[model samples]
Target: MQPSRPLDVVYDPLYTTSTSHNKYEGHKRRVVPNKRPISIKNNSGLVSGPERHKYFCRPVLPHLQAETPEVLYASAHDAANIMSISEDLSASTRSIGMQTMYRDSHAQTDPFSPEYVLPEGAVAPEIESLTNLRYRKGLPVTQAEIRMIEHNRKKKALKKVLPPMSDEASLNLRKRMMEAQEIMDLKFRENEIDEAHARRIEALQESLAEREKQSQAINSERMRRLEKTLMLEKEDANRRNQHDRIKELRKLANKRQRIQTILNQGSKKRDLIEEYADYASPVYAPQMRNGNLVRKSPVPEVQFKDHQLMTLDSIRELEKNLPPQIRTSPKNQFLKRAPLMKKSRDQMTMETHLLNVESAINKQHVQGEEKLPSSPYKGQYRAILQRPSTPNYAPQIAEAGSEVNALRLLQRLIRGRAVQNMMYEGKDRRAELIAELRESEEARRFLSSSFQVPAEETEITKSAFSHVEGEVVSELLDVLQKELIRNKEIAKVYDFAQKAAEDRHQREIEEGARRQLEDLARDRHDQIYCFVTDIHRSTANDYIDSIFEDAVEDLTYRDSVVQSIIMTKVIDPILNILEEENSEDTIVKDLVSSFLFPWVQKHHTQDQALLEKRKYTSAIQALLAKVSQSMRI
Candidate 1:
């Protein structure tokens, strides 16, 4: 069976009232320490076990019924009992509110907090008695009452222990204290006088020091100013002398240069004034030829107004010939225009909406049938009077305007301002004609179909002009034969030329392909060369380092000879192989182990030679590895 949730813990009303309402305010008296915050789960349900069941009994929910007969019957009975108990509890709780039961609980705690402490004698006996009678409550002592009780107890105990002082002894003690105060006052005055004297002496010394510091600062400032002035005067004098000497030297140098120039080229020497005077020409003057120094004619100055007027005229001309303007604003858009002329057909003929002819015909046929007698119809019909076919007719339309207008004729013949204007007018006329043709139903119907020559015209023309005279035919044949012979010759020449062109184009294409191949080859060659150079440059230092390391290791003559032999044979060959395009790790290893190792072993069987050989081979391997790293391809 499942258990119900435990009751919530409620704080005692007396404790709540005693506790400070404002948590922020500081308490003068030490507050009664709270051991810990009250937990609703731990402290709730003070009355537990069978004692709790006597009052606020909560029934446990019955377990789910099982298939077994015994368990199922027991569960049914338990559920029934639990349900009845819950209903009764709910009824009781409804009458006496849940909060009233919580308030009636006996469990209570007190903190004696100072906030709820009442003034002395504030609660009269009569009021306390009335509260106890009406509310069935007892007055509990406030925090103030507790403190007062404690203080009075302490005071009574102290009064029984300590005796009061006599009046003569108190007066004598006061007199001694007064005499001691006088002596202290005299000593304090003497100390003040000493401090004042010392302060005066210190002030005098400070004043003297301040005066000395000011005088020294003033004297130093004057000396610095005097030195600066003298230094500036000396610099000015030196600068003036330098300037004078430079001027004199410059004048001498100029004179010497002028004399030298005159002697060498026989050209006239001019001073700054003369040089500037030669440039004294009007600002608006035309530039002259270098040697002539004279213009053949002066350039004419165009006026702004005339220039602007010419530009404006060109702009206006361009604007006048511009294409039709487009309407940008819908509000100002062009409205549909009235037809240029009245439509030729009537409104009824123009209407495209088709009428329901079947309805009309059926109505007419019904009326006719109704009017006629109903009779058995025969297959044969009597011959009736034939109706004459409607005479083929068309409306005879007269021209609306005068047949001949001299002014209109003259206007049509008048030449436009330019050929462009004439073409524009022609284009406008054609556009108008096309629009009119599209607007006309009959014309549009005729134009929608493919056009063909009239059969009558074709027959007439074929018969009339099909035959040619013998002489003319013979002449035409001769001319054609001559033309065909010429065309044949031309075709032969064209064929040869085309073949030549094709051959040349093929050669050019081949040449371009060859050149591209050469360029790619050259680029690859250059890249390889740069890679080789980088490898050589980067390995040069490593080679030197290896040789140095080898020299340090090998001190004897045979070792030196072995080193030289290794350098000339092993290292050089390995480097050459590393630079080669087909160089690989196997090839390098073969060069070092197969060729160099056997040669070294044959030349020198000593241990040092063997050691040097190993070092050289290792160095060669290192060099090859470094080169391999630096290799681009």
Candidate 2:
């Protein structure tokens, strides 16, 4: 069996190595790989190890694993190259591919060369069944076929061991499926019911809202009608009052003219009668009976004075007999007397009473504690007569002239010294003038000082004025300086007091205006809150947008809008968040006070809008609390 040339290592399943033991042969072969060197000279050979197997076969594993129809031709080609069994195979081999294969008995080349030496104790590796026959024959072998076979075996094994489902199990599964279907149906019905209920509620809300709008419209109409009626009535009353006032004025004017004419007529008639009596005859004098003037009474016992004795009949008789001038005289016109209408009579009586009462009061006031009749006048009188008088604490305002006079005095002194120098320009009168001014200054200082003078006549006056005008200058300067100092002190005090009073007045005015604005804002807040929040959930932004353009000039409206914004934008959102998070009344309030209060304080601080919103803090907080409580309920 030994060959002279190195031969291909043809695979043989029955071949044994020197280290292998064969029970059938009843011999234990000795491991002599190092000595024998398992080459072509030796018949026994070692089997290929995993390294050799992988190097030769796994390189073509992908090609071998192909199961496509094209792989059939390749396999035939490989088969023909190895076997050379048929012409068709040979033709297929040459045409489809150029690959070659070897049979078990065929010799190609020895993987181990003749000179190769095996290592000591080397043994042939056991054959892997994965590459058994196909590898030995140099045919294609792959894991894909082995895996398919393994999968089929596992499937059959599982099928043989697994048990079938029982009737009870099938029934239980069917029951679960039916229950699931019933649950789905029940959920669908509940959703439908909920949707229908929501629709009904929405419809009811719409109807109620419509009714409310109608009622509001009717009420507004009634209110407008009532207002219009009241306005007409007021106008009518005012017009009637104006008419009555005009009539009363006309009557007064006519009464005044009649009184004036009567007064002039009486005066003229008296003057004419006096002139006639003095120049004409003694008969012109008022004729009198035994104890009466001019006319006797119808009753013999009745006696009257000259004017009272004259009757209407006598005046008419005189009018007819007199000349035209005397006939038409105003005295004879009885209609031109004092006003005889009741209203005019009443007015005259009132005036006469007022004058009489005033005169009596003056007489009583002037008489000094003398007892007199009580005054009939019940109206208020100024017991302490009001007149313009100086205040007790009169401020002494500094006169402008005082400071100017002091400055002028200094100027005058300086001018005098300069003039003195000019008069003695090149002479030595400077020392004399200095001595004279010094003497005058010393005398003035001594007099102005708080030193007591002697009771006896002092000779101070003799040394007072060293020069002609020095005495006047020193005295006037002292007075002016004192006046200037006093004026400054007065001015300072007056300015401080005036500033204090002005500040106080300003504060009072500010406080009053603030109070009025707060009152207005509060009223506006109520109106806006009622209008904005009266309906269901809605924001103030929509309402604000509707009115913002039209009501730009209305500050109250703007303030109300700002307040509503604060409620909706700031207050409502925070309240809703707090409500959703925690519904407890106490917890909600605490959260509002802790979180919302500070937030509102920080954000609601634009000056004009701030005043509008800050005032409603308490109201808004209460509203928040109320809303939270409602949500909880």
Candidate 3:
């Protein structure tokens, strides 16, 4: 026919439907019979139900089949099995037959498919043919090949065409193209290099800016803190200076107060002295004058009375001339001698001078007048004068001696006035001094209360200076001496205290030095030594060890010696001198017994080797025996 047509293939969905229904023929739906004739129910003579149903059905319903879950599940399973079988068959066949069939279908003419026609209302452009080009024999006419051919044909058509520019212009155009490409490449390289450099520059700038900001902040903070510190320091310094000035003012005020007090005391003393001088001047002058006027020579000249001597001799001759019996007899001799012994020479002279006294006494005696005694030397003479003596004359003489003793006592009273005056002077001076001191103390107290020291440490500083001025050792010695003399028990207590303090001090020093040496040994491995040399050395190492031990022993001995010196020379002597009750001999014995003897015993006991080497044990025993004997004494 028009060119042998290929066989047409048709698909019949009705045949598939009929065959599917036959397979499920027993499960088909049955029609339901109408049980009653169709009738309209009249409501107000209108067909409302059918009319409303027709109105509701006016809108189109979607023509989609509703699928049950079982149908959808079974259909999905069947499709999955079919896809798996198709995939397996396609994999085995490599889909070559399918691809051939698809190509064939794509080439069929159908208006609905893209393979049927070109696009609507679109036309292909016209192409001009080349006349002077020779055809290539074996070139394939693919689209690309066709494009190449068209390009060659265009070149042949333009074979007679001249260049639009001269040779120079063309060369310039080629050069320009190369130059543009070079420029683009250079720009790209520059962009890449500058990108890294730019990033580095940006980072450095940012770092610099950050550092500057931090530096400025630190500097500002430091300056602010420094300013605050400076202000505080300046304020503190000003406060200290003010305190110093105040302290100086207070001290000056105190000094002025002390000076004023001293001046007032002086003025008061002077006034008192002037007042006392009024009573003292006149009385002292007269007493001095009377004393000078009545002054007598301490020694008296010796003189003898001639008349009294002659009378005494004449009396003795008269006594010798008396009868031998009366002279020998005790009663007559006593009677003769009593008047002679009783009457003094002065009384005889007074009797001789005043002869009337003897004459009157004799006349009064004759007339029973009081009989006065005659002198013993004048008794014989008195017998010649025929004078009588009174019996009461002996009592009068005893009374006269008593009166003389009273006068002597009066003289002693006069001598005691000098001692009273001395006592008065001492008491007066002490009173005035005490008054002045009291006034000074009052002034000092007022000043101290009124003006305080500026510094808290100012009082301590002043006390320290005062302490430097006051020698502590001298004060301690004075106190010790006073206590020893005043109270023996207190003195013993103080002595014990002093000994305890000294022992404590020595122990502290020893311990401190020991600690220091231990530390030094730990730190530097060194030792300190004190030594006494031997005359000869033994083996070297043994000698060295012996020397070290000897050195330590010597040091111990030296320490003992130092302790002895401190106790005996410094401490014991101080105690002994101040001990008022203990006699010198007793103190010496006590010291030797209590201290020295014990010390010797300890020394001998401690140094057995030395005692043996020196053969000193016997001597020590002897010395100890002597010491024991001395202590007993």
Candidate 4:
């Protein structure tokens, strides 16, 4: 008989040994049955003293009983049949049968056989032979049964199994695998090259499109510049023409003045002499002598006809006689007595006065006394020529006529001189007046001509160009400013977005690390029930609280910074719009309010906290305040 191998056992007790021993001792002890005695004699094979006492003391069996041999045989056969049926059932189920079959097949092959060995002295043949034997045995099995057997065999074979290939063969196989991998890598590199070429082509097309747009913009700008230059040239030409016309008119005026001066100098002296001569000459001559009187006449007495003389005398006498009565009257006195009486009285008086004066005065007074004596004789001679008393009227009439003629001539000369002087003065004055009139007329003509190009039309044209240029300048300024602001905002937004993305990435990393720590803690708790208690009690709660607080503070700070940025970027622009509105800057205000505000609102949604902040509303309120203040200004 073979001795059985010793069994190995290990036991663990949680509590201390003393505590276990104390508990065991306190329990009531249970009694076990004593062993039954067996009788054997040492050499004769008889019962011994201790064995005889045990056998005699034991009861003996009574008389014989008959047994059925056939019954026993039948029982044995039935037991054998039952065992066979069980075997058949296990085989039909397939998994148990396949496992047994694979074991039997592998048992037939020697593990150390040459067929199971490899050339390099490694043991691939053993694994191969075992796998082959298992495969053959399992071929008739169902798919499920074969899978179960294969799984069991792989699990068993994995333990203490030799390497599948010899060392040299494995190196060659690895090299082939590496070559295949290199081929796949080369194919992938070719695909990447094609993709890069496509990208380059697309970039070039985009650049070409941009260049075309730039060329069009340059052309438009050049055309505008050319138009402006042409307009300036035209204006200069018109001004030059106006100046030339004015110069021509001045030259004509100088020529007219020179002609007028020549006419004045030639006419002056001749006119003065003619006026003096006309005054000096008389219409008739008067006769005059120097100082002496001479008598030149003989009296040829023309005798009147006798009848006429007598009749004259008679008539005188008759008239005297008839008018003696009437003579005394005022009307008839002169006709009646004048002739005869005057002659007689004159004769008497002459004789008496002559004698008396001659006597009274002596000769010197009458020195020519001799002449008095000759007076009688002189009667026969020519009666003392008594000069007929010439009347003084001729002198008076002559003086009056000369005075009148002189006055008339003087008046004529004065009038002529006045007329000539007036003509000379008027000629110069008229020239000037005409020149003034011509200038005024020309100015009027120019003004009238200018009206053909109405001021409103010219002004409208000018204003249209000015408005277009101003709009261009304003638009350019606006676009440039907007672009600058947009660029600045984009930079800020990019920075903010980058910061946010960074923060998110950092948070994800922290969360992943925290989860890993939590998993480690949980694993430690599962493995050793109390391992995590110190960490849980002392560090975890405080760390979580600090992290939450810090996160909130950082978010609040970021929000504040974003709000300030928005105020600088967006609020100020809005305030400008509002200010413009208050000043009645309609064009500017309309552009900003209508075009810019909506643009800003759309831009704010990207920031997490900024989106939640009521920044737009606050900015609008601030702008309104600014507008109100500006109105007061």
Best by TM-score: 2
lDDT of each: 0.57, 0.60, 0.59, 0.60
Residue 180, candidate 1: alpha-carbon lDDT: 60
Clashes of each: 0, 2, 7, 5
RMSD of each: 56.1, 52.8, 59.0, 57.7
lDDT of 4 by residue, 1-633 (tens): 652532111122232343435443232222233453467334666677744755533233443422122211222235687798788777846443222432544653213212111233333322342333434464445664554556546544543343345688866776676575567557656766676555755565567569879999999999999999999999788668756755654454455445333433332223433433353322111122522343333223445575643767777876766746666655544445455585686578557656744554452343333223322222232123233332345578777998889999999999999999999999887998889999999989977887689779879978998999999999999999999999999999999999998678656655765688699999887877655676676688899899999999999999999999999999999999888667667766788899988877677555655755678878889999999999999
- Kindly list the per-residue Cα lDDT of model 3 for residues 138-169, writing each as its tens digit: 22234534654555455444433434455898
Minimal lDDT window, size 10, model 1: 126-135
Worst lDDT run of 10 residues, candidate 3, spans: 109-118
TM-score of each: 0.14, 0.18, 0.17, 0.16
Q: What lDDT does candidate 1 reach at residue 147?
A: 46
The model with the greater TM-score, 1 or 4, is 4
Instruction: Compose the digit string of candidate 1's lDDT tens values, residues 226-298.
Output: 9999999998997798568657655755665554443333222224334323444322232455222443323
Better structure of 3 and 4 per lDDT: 4
lDDT by residue (tens digit), candidate 2, 1-633: 786542222233355555665443422233223374555485357456655554443123434532322222222235555465466565744554332444365744323211122233553222222222444453354564454445545544544554444788866765676576567557756866676656765675577679989999999999999999999999899779856865775575566556444434433223433544353432233334423254322222435577842799877776687788755646544555664896786677668656755765574465435433243232223133222232232233245568778899999999999998787874564778788889999979988772566634344544543554687788999999999999999999999999998678656655765688699999999999887776533556667766886677688788999999899999999989977888698786896799988877777665658677777997899999999999999
